[model samples]
Target chain A: GAGVSQSPSNKVTEKGKDVELRCDPISGHTALYWYRQSLGQGLEFLIYFQGNSAPDKSGLPSDRFSAERTGGSVSTLTIQRTQQEDSAVYLCASSPNPVYEQYFGPGTRLTVT
Target chain B: AQRVTQPEKLLSVFKGAPVELKCNYSYSGSPELFWYVQYSRQRLQLLLRHISRESIKGFTADLNKGETSFHLKKPFAQEEDSAMYYCALKGFGNEKLTFGTGTRLTIIP
Candidate 1:
């Protein structure tokens, strides 16, 4: 079976630019999650989506970070006006339910200069 | 606030030796604990969960509520076990998990 997939495995951008990272969850998965892995922060939860309900945005570090899942399948994480501090590997994961284990993607390495 | 803590940044043991990776967490409520492993050049994947009580590839973790600990261990370490292991916890209501800093384990041959 196909696992979760993320596009543009690596991205490099200027400090003030914006970037969009995409994630395609495993087929039939109804829940999606986004996380960031920085040198010092380990892995921090970003946001989560379950069905048609409002996404859990509590983990978004700032107003510039946002994520959306469409058709209950694919998700996109956008960082607007990114800063050098945003440099890290963005990881995506999916699960059938909140209590189930999640399958993770290879991740997109974002470098903000 | 829910949090997972892996005290060791790195652990090294020879093949066929016993191995233990300590993980402690802090959460106000009952939490679901898990151990995730990432092999060389591979995506992170679930190794075992305390709730399942099933060992995967010879690895097992026990949840101790009194100590707030869920340490992963194996009787005999294998070289293939060398990788980064992360301890994670999910609270009863939260839809996402809080992870720890992770421990890099190396099983020397």
Candidate 2:
């Protein structure tokens, strides 16, 4: 079966620029998650979506970070006015349910220079 | 606040030797504990979960509420086991997971 997939394996941008990262969850998966991996913070949860309910954005580091899942399938994470600190590997994952095991994507490495 | 901690940044053991990767977590309520592994050039994947009480790839972990710990153990190490291991916790009814910094285990042949 196809696993979760992310776009733009690597991205390099200047500070203050905006970037959009896309994620395509596995078919029939109702739960989607966005996480960030960096040298300083390790792995940190960014946001999560479950069905049509409200998304969980508690883990977003700042107001500049936002994400939206459409049609209960594809998700896009947007970071506005990116800072050097925002440089990290953005990973996406999906699960059949909240309690089930999650499958991860190859991740997009974002570099803010 | 929920948190997971992996004390060791890196651990090395010879093949056929016993290995233990320590993990401790702090949460207000009962939490679901999991071990995720990532091999070189591979995406992170679930290695085992405490609730399942089943071993995967010869790895096992036990949840100890009293100590607030869930440590991964293997009786015999293999070179293939060399990879990054992360301990994670999800609070009851919560969708987000708190993850540890991760431990890089290297099995020497």
lDDT of each: 0.94, 0.95
lDDT of 1 at A61: 96
Which pairs clash in the backbone of model 2?
A: none
lDDT of 1 by residue, A46-81 (tens): 999998999999999999999988899999999999
Model 2's i-RMS, to one decimal, reads 1.1
i-RMSD of all predictions: 1.0, 1.1
| Chain B TM-score by candidate, in order shown | 0.98, 0.98
The DockQ of each candidate is 0.85, 0.81
Give a tens-digit lDDT track for model 2, residues A1-113.
Answer: 88999998999999999999999999999999999999955589999999999999998999999999999999999999999999999999999998899899999999999
DockQ of 1: 0.85
Query: If scored against the real structure, what TM-score would every candidate get?
Result: 0.98, 0.98
* True A-B contacts kept by model 2: 0.79
